[model samples]
Target: MKKILHAGNNLKGKQANPTYISFLGPKLEAVGFTLYYTSQKQNKVLRLIDMLLSVYKYRAKVDLVLIDTYSTSNFYYAFLVAELCNLLKTPYITILHGGNLPKRLDKSTWKSKRLFKHSKLNIAPSKYIMHEFKKRAYSNIKFIPNALNIEKYEVTERGCERLKLLWVRSLTPIYNPDMALEVVRLLQNEGLDVSLTMVGPDPHNKFEELKETINNKKLRIEYKGKLKQEEWYKLSENHNIFINTSNFDNMPITLIEAMALGLPLVSTNVGGIPYLIEDGKEGLLCNKDDALTMVNCIKKIHKNPDLRQSLIVNARSKAESFSWQNVKALWISALA
Candidate 1:
């Protein structure tokens, strides 16, 4: 069997683990590619060193390498690893995951140049990043969305009366977990029968403060820390609406999974979210950190049965486009 060396920060402890390497690596292995991983270390500098060593160690063992390139500080990891891969003469491909990566081009032009130029190809899971790279004359890029096994999701009918809101992502400041709490508080103040369930690991230890705010405000919220893929989908059956309050986002698999399970989304129009969700179409979009607008959106969806069902139908249709059955061929062609 051929081999693949995947280099990325595998969010090992996070509950809503949407790491692309974890999702795609096994799929590649099932099709006869032996997958190897590096750098589950939380520290950034150590992770970069680990990734470099991984490339050197697997230099002759792997068929190709896959790097998860981000637009944030982690972008340096991709650059350093790509430089090592170039010296080793190993062909590598990068999967772009940063929503704010367009700025990376202007800020770190030289590094971005070296990273993409050395790679055999760059796979962008969202058109948001793909368009930005293309405009900058980066031609070694391919648009392939983050995908999931559709068979795993179970769809259920949702009552538009009670707002059973669900938020799934790591409890990090960037994701703005606090924003979800504030939205729930605002809605409850208006006497809306709303409840929020947040499912994800708190890597930053922010749970105590978050819990205090919830208790202080007396909000109807439940924190289910870190659920398995199957467990979350099963939990979705008891919920209706899915909320994504990320300050920055890429093609989030949880958002796609929610749509597949027929959950209408009310998310901030930041990063790649707009690219994935069309306002008043597949899902509702609001401004970042605007609790009032989110409250209004939830009220709109709750009152209008027609609008709610329309979003469900359209979102599910759009989600079907990202199923593994549809994306498997793209991976096969890329690897071949």
Candidate 2:
């Protein structure tokens, strides 16, 4: 069995959504790969130090290092870790996670090359990211969509008489949680009976802003801060529609989970989302921050039961392709 050191945010118990390492690490272990992980420290500087120390400590024992690469400040973590891996003559693979990474590649060309070019392989979770990298002449990359246990997400029967929207993402500016609020407000203004439930952590303290908007607009919105996967899966049963209002996104696992649970999707068509869901096929798509378009999309599903059922069926079918049973083999092969 190959020994792998997975490096990324492992803050499962820290009231944050489980990152890629939290999910993929266990899957790798179950398939006979021994796995070690890094820094659960919430502080940025401390987390970087802990990650570097883990790499140094496991340098001799592990056959490979798996770095969860992102586009923001965490990008520096991957760069420094990869640099250390290079110095130590250890092979490392970068698992790309940020939806805005294409912009990073353009903005930090030299750093991107230094970090990605030297890796054993770069794993892209979406074709959107893969295409971006290939366009920049980065050939040592592969596409592996994020995976989940499809069987765990039981499909729920839904009704359209009263629209219930479900939004799951961190309350961050980039995700544009405000757009979800605006979408709900617009639907209510149209004399439509709509209620929204948001589930996520407020690392940047954006929940207060969301609350103020909800109160001022007098909208029916429930803010369920940071729920466990199963907790929100149960809450999803009450919701008929899933709204993804992110300005930028990669292959979000929540969208797949919503699909598996039989919720019709209405998402902003940005980054890899269109690649994930075909417009008027598996789900409906609108431009970023355009709440009116999203409202119209929801209205279409409300008026047409056939369209809703079709989207639910098609989306669930697409989500099955992302199940761990199907995707584990790809990871096994790639690691080999």
Candidate 3:
């Protein structure tokens, strides 16, 4: 049996760690491949040493290595992973998950261009990301949409009294949690009995700032810090509107989960949002950083029953195309 090393840092006992790293393990193992994953901290000083140690440890066993892309185009890890793979004479693939990499590259003073130049293969989750990399004429790139299995959400109304808006992302700067806070404030200011549940753990770095934003704005937000994926999905079913405040995102699983739950979507038009949404169709996209526009989009769905019903129908249908069974075939083809 062929052995593969899953080279990515992990957060101790965190879902995102196992969840993201376990992607290729099952599928590859089904085909008689042995997958070994070792999680390491992302600290630069120690990270390089840990990676070299991993390469040395796995050198004699694994046939191939798949490196997880560091979040938001941190160029540092990408370079290290690629260069390490080269030094060890091992073949590797880098899955680029940062949807806002294009913006960072455009604004970056760092040497992303130079570091990524030696990358073997770049696996992008959406065309939006691929488009950004392709614009720079990067080769050896493939578009692999986020693999999602269709979820079963029992359609039922949780109470029609107050409009429930759900935000299921980390309270991080990249996600622009303040936009969510501001939108909720706008809803309450308009005398709307809207309730918001912000689900997801603090990325540690931005939790304090996020709390300050909520306290400063005096918004009506319930910080339900980090929910299990299943719980969050179940919660999404009870919610009416799903909002994504990410200023930089490719295809977010949150939006897909919302669609599967038959909840209408109102997201900012940034990163690869356009790839997942057909404005006024499956979902609505607002100009990035425009809390008023985001609020207006949600209010539009809240007020018009027919519009909400149509969008729910359309969004659910669009989401079907991204099911794990369906998307895996695309990934297989890309690997071919």
Candidate 4:
């Protein structure tokens, strides 16, 4: 069995949602690969130190180091870790993430090149990221869609008697949680009976602003801060629609989970979302921050039963292609 050191935010119980490492580590282990993970430390500085130390400690023991590369300040963590791997003559792979990463490549060209070009492989979860890297002439990149256990997600029939909108993501500025509230407000203003439930942690304290807006506007919005996967899956049974209002995103696992649960999707067509859901096919997409368009998309789904059924069937089909059974071979081949 190959020994792999996976480095990323393994913050499953740390008041944050499970990231890629948290999900992928166990899957790899179950498939006969020995996996080690690093840096569940919440503090940024301490986390960086821990990640660096883990790389140094496991440098000789592990066959490969899997770095979860992102576009934010955490990008620096990936850069430093990859450089450490390079200096220690250890093979490493970068699992690319975040929709803003293409911008990061342009903004930090030299750093991006050093970090990605020297890696053993660059794994892109979406074609958007793959295309962006290929555009810059990077040949070490490969497309591997993110995986989930499709059997765990139970699909339920959606009754269109009332609109129950579900939004699942961190309450961050980039995700634009406020847009969800606005979409709900617009639907209600147009004399539609709609209620929204937002599930996510407020890492940046944006929930305070959202709470104020919900109170002031008197919208029927329920803010359930940071639920476990199963908890939210149960909550999803009450919801008929899943809305993603992120201003920027990669291929979000939540959207795929929503598809598996048979919730018709209405998302902003930003970043890699278009690559995930074709407009009017698997789901409906609108411009970023355009609450009105999202409202219209919801209205379209609610009014048209055939369209809703088509979206649910098509989306669930697309999501099944991302199951772990199908995707594990890609990982096994890439790792080999």
Please report the TM-score between candidate 1 and the true structure: 0.95
Which pairs of residues collide in model 4?
none
Query: Taking the tens digit of each residue's C-alpha lDDT, what string does model 1 give over 176-269?
Result: 9999999999999999899999998877778888999999999999998889888988899888889989998879888999999999999999
True-structure RMSD for candidate 3: 2.8
Candidate 2 ranges beyond 4 A from true positions: none
What is the C-alpha local distance difference test score of each model?
A: 0.89, 0.93, 0.75, 0.93
Which window of ten consecutive residues has the lowest lDDT sum in model 3?
Answer: 10-19
Lowest summed lDDT over 10 consecutive residues: which window, candidate 2?
11-20
Deviation in angstroms for 127 in model 2?
0.7
User: Candidate 4 lDDT, tens digit per residue, 55-80?
Assistant: 99998899999999999999999999
Instruction: Select the stronger candidate by lDDT from 1 and 3.
Output: 1
Per-candidate TM-scores read 0.95, 0.99, 0.88, 0.98
Off by over 4 Å in 3: 14-19, 40-48, 71-74, 103-117, 151-161, 205-218
